[model samples]
Target: MSLVYAKNDWYAIAAADEMTLGQQRQTLLLGTPLTVTATDEGVVVRDDQGKTYPYQIKFDHVWTALGDAPRALFDIPEGDEPGRRCVPCGVVRVKCSPLRAVENFLDIAHFPFVHTDILGAEPHTEVEPYKVEIREEQDEVWATKVRFFQPKAAKSAGSGITTEYEYRVPAPTVAVLYKTCPPKPEAQDVIAIFVQPRGEEECDVWPWMALYDDESSFEELVQFQQEIFLQDRSILENQLPHRLPLDPKMEIPTRADMTSVAYRRWLKKRGALYGAMTEVA
Candidate 1:
């Protein structure tokens, strides 16, 4: 099996919680083994060759690159706002391509079937038309005007409501979603998925959130988000071919897949080949 990751981009290598003093851990990234150590100066990551790479801690994870990154890390404006709880939902390692995992996040039609009554239920599986465009300036894909009915959109949600949704793909292996906040209808909640590719068919996914929820405990928030992803993990790991097909003809798409189409195109246009199927079978 031959897989090529986008070498000129940033990826999350470790979580902040794992950087306890005097602690050391080993993990793989793009098929390379690295040693992660926590020291007085902060966490340091070095490869088997003893060469250490520069890293930064952001959104509760350690970000690094195997090659010289061509672009700066994307920002999360909602994360800087006041009164919003910042919850880093931790890591979920899956036996699937990082691209497939991301495409799954940008999908809403599966909520009723995969997430069940929590995110959606029977007779409410219809996904409204959404506007999708690629921001040429930033080379990002965005989808707007999305609306869906949810049984329980958030832990703070008391009942079902029509949720307003917007999706953004600022990076190939990362996706951000803006949805109606149950606690504050005027503002939206931000949920981002940052995937760290261990290889072509495996990855570590870090889910982070910036929300207006004050009622749900931190533990409850983590559990709720993890549960949602665990539900997705079932489909992610079992999907045929494992990697995401960038070719539109490989898998038929409906109107509800507008954002996914844009995402695949953006990936292709940018030449981000990590965990992507570029050729027809």
Candidate 2:
């Protein structure tokens, strides 16, 4: 996992709000040379060789599945309190697995079963029409779009209305999506999460929330989404492949496995496509 993480490619470190301007800190994740600096215009990432890349803190959690040991580097200024270490890069790297399994989870069809409690459709429930899009390169890398029809009375009454929760992956480990209610048909709410694979079997999960109408509302949403991530992290890390099964018998995916099935099929096709292209070339 660590080897694939390019020192040159722009990788997400932390949220912009966490670090102020003109501040530099050193971190250990992704190697000891990692350094993060905040400038007036924006943020900059510097390698050991003084090579710097200007960037924006797009995701809240810096996740990786590089090496066998997963670690998180939180940039705490030197002048903070006692027992505080300033993490220049705020790069949290965990070893969960390669980026592939993470991609499979986003398939709308899998939510109904794999993650039944938090995200899923009841048996016999038809999923609202949604499109699987592969947009621009810099577009949300890992993304999902889903919508479901729900009864209006059940929604406002806090009756756990039937709704669609769509998640889009914009990077190797970022999830961005919308959740909506009836009457107010607009998807005004968004949840963005970053999952870094630490080593080969662990992961660091960070989640942030924001409203499309009000961006600043991210403050409270951050806390709310973080808790949900905590729950997800606990379950994901415990399950095989971090909530995925290497062997089907251990966890059988049924009709609700549509999403996972689709994802697997896509991956296979991608592999074949790339393989043929390589051979032909």
Candidate 3:
């Protein structure tokens, strides 16, 4: 797999709390060196050569791009809704391709095997049929009416219940999940994974949430998300081929993998080749 990246896009490299006042923090995104420093007014970002870059603070992280002409970041309307508990679960560095991480996040069929009783259990291993499609208007992949039985859907969940979910992939490196909120039955809980490409086979993933729960503490919420992702990290680090294979022949897909197939096609269509294996010349 070649180390290629779509440079003209925003990626979350560091947590908002990481930028200490007047202290410069540096990192690598898509294999480019970048730095950030906190100030009284705002955060300042610079390249390895000390040249400044455009940046914004959203979803409790600093987003910036390496390419000179970059695409605009997507908006998360739920981030502003009143009474929603916005939680940043922090970052987890994984030794796997960023694209692979996003693909894994879009899958739920592994719950019964990987997540076990926490997310699913035996006899409830079947993944019901769901609809997946690419929305041309937004250039995003969407999966609707996804339902699964969970032993504990969330930290606030008091008992096992069938959970309804919707998945959206707005960017090549980001995945947004909308699921049923236990407390607010009429509303949904939004959880997202922002992948910061560090190298072809490495990335720093940040999980965030906008929930309607009032029962779980901030620490509890963060811990709950961390536990699930850490379990995923183990599988991510050990998968063969490191990068994702866009060629369907490289790896077969099932009905449950429609979102993944849609994602690969979307990446191919957009030429977002970082951390991917494609047959296209």
Evaluated with lDDT, which candidate comes out highest? Answer: 3
What is the lDDT of every predicted structure here?
Answer: 0.88, 0.42, 0.89
lDDT of 2 by residue, 151-254 (tens): 32111223446566665554444445556733345533454445443333444444444343222233443443343334344445444434233233444656
Model 1 ranges with Cα > 4 A deviation: 1-5
Single out the weakest 10-residue window by summed lDDT for candidate 2: 272-281
Candidate 1 vs candidate 2: the lDDT winner is 1
Decreasing TM-score order of the candidates: 1, 3, 2
Per-residue lDDT of 13-68 in model 3, one digit per residue for the tens?
Answer: 77887776886778888787887888776787877788887788899888988776
Give the Cα error of residue 197 in candidate 2, in Å: 4.7
Cand. 3 TM to true fold: 0.96
Cα error, residue 202 of model 3, in Å, equals 0.2
Screening candidate 1 with a backbone cut-off below 3 angstroms (N, C-alpha, C), the clashing residue pairs are none
Q: Rank all candidate structures by their lDDT, best first, as comma-separated numbers.
A: 3, 1, 2
